[model samples]
Target: MIQIKDLHKSYKMGSNSLHVLKGINFNVEEGELVSIMGSSGSGKSTLLNILGMLDEADEGSYTLDGVPIKNLNERVAAKYRNKFLGFIFQSFNLINYKSALDNVALPLYYQKMPRKERMDRAFHYLEKVGLAEWSHHLPSELSGGQKQRVAIARALASDPKVLLADEPTGALDSKTSHEVMELIQGINDEGKTILIVTHEPDIAQMTKRIVNLKDGIIIDDHKVEQIRASQYV
Candidate 1:
């Protein structure tokens, strides 16, 4: 569903050039679960931002599904992001004042979807994430896992083909992190492609494949045994 070839991103800092992505090339198939692992400054997050089109790559080619996005204007990129990509950040990025259902429904507002239809879609995804009973609660009222669930629900509300998650389990305890992983894995099984960025090896191990990034390039790629069930044990 996604192909990135010879991607390069650099920032001009005074007289020096800082390269964030160094000719990275990768492909993610439909319904696949993939993870990118890297240390700080290794550029996994930058790659994720570029993949989500939150940040533009300075050079090379990026094709989503089949459309070329290497040179789309901001307005077009934003529209494409809303329509085709779902993003989950390390910080959850939920509005503190909005209820879980409202938070999930925010993305659909730009499409001018009917209120009833938007509400129906948001509520359904909330229920899918096991948050049906808590839809009305604000982010502050939820636990870490619950907040992440809401984030996941928000990402899925648009029925995006691919979900881009950055350090999704970064804030949770190990047990809760496993639960979130199970939820992500479930999404992949149901045919949503997911690419997650994680620094933890154990977390990366839960996905179908692992790709390690170093110095802005993919250094290692390996396919693990497929997850038979949610539980790692």
Candidate 2:
């Protein structure tokens, strides 16, 4: 579903350039559940940004679902990003003023989907995430796990080709993390391509494959016997 080759990225810091990703290469097939692991200064976040089209690589290639992801104008880039990628971040990234249902419907709003259709779709996903009863609650009114579920629902509401999660469980307690992972596992079971960036070993074990990144390159990539998150939840 996604491919990357000889990917390189750098940023200027006054007089010197800080190389973040150097010659990174990998491919994630359709329906695969993968984890990208790295410590501080590793390029996992940068890689996710490039994949999400929020940033561009200085060198190399990225192809998502058969289309090249480079040299696009902002308008085209935004269009592709909206159509192809869904994101979940550690911070939840919800608008505090908006109710959970409105937050999920926001993306569909940008897609110019009809009001009734967007709301209906958003509610369906919220229901899928087990948040239907709390749909009217604001982000501030929900617990950490509830907020994350709302965020996940919002991500899925777009029905994108890939789901990229950056430290998705970083902020939650262990039990809540497992519950969220359980939900994620069920999603993958239905054939959604997911890439999670996490440092926790237990969290990484839940995925079908793990890709370890050091400095700027993939140091190890292998498939594992998947651990069902439901056992822990």
Q: Best candidate, lDDT-wise?
A: 2
Candidates' TM-scores? Answer: 0.96, 0.99
Candidate 1 versus the native: TM-score?
0.96
Give the worst 10-residue stretch by lDDT in candidate 2.
78-87
Candidate 1: where are CA atoms >4 Å away?
227-229
Candidate 1 lDDT tens digits, 1-233: 99999999998999999998999999998988999999999999889889898888888899998988867788999899988999887789999999999999998887789999999999999999999999999999999999999999999988887999999999988888888998988888899999999998888888999999999999998899865335752
Q: Extract clashing residue pairs from model 2.
A: none
Q: For candidate 2, what is the TM-score?
A: 0.99
In model 1, state the lDDT of residue 228.
Answer: 38
Measured on C-alpha atoms, candidate 1 has an lDDT of 0.90
Give the per-residue lDDT digits (tens) of candidate 2, residues 78-100: 99988998889999999999999
Clashes of 1: 0
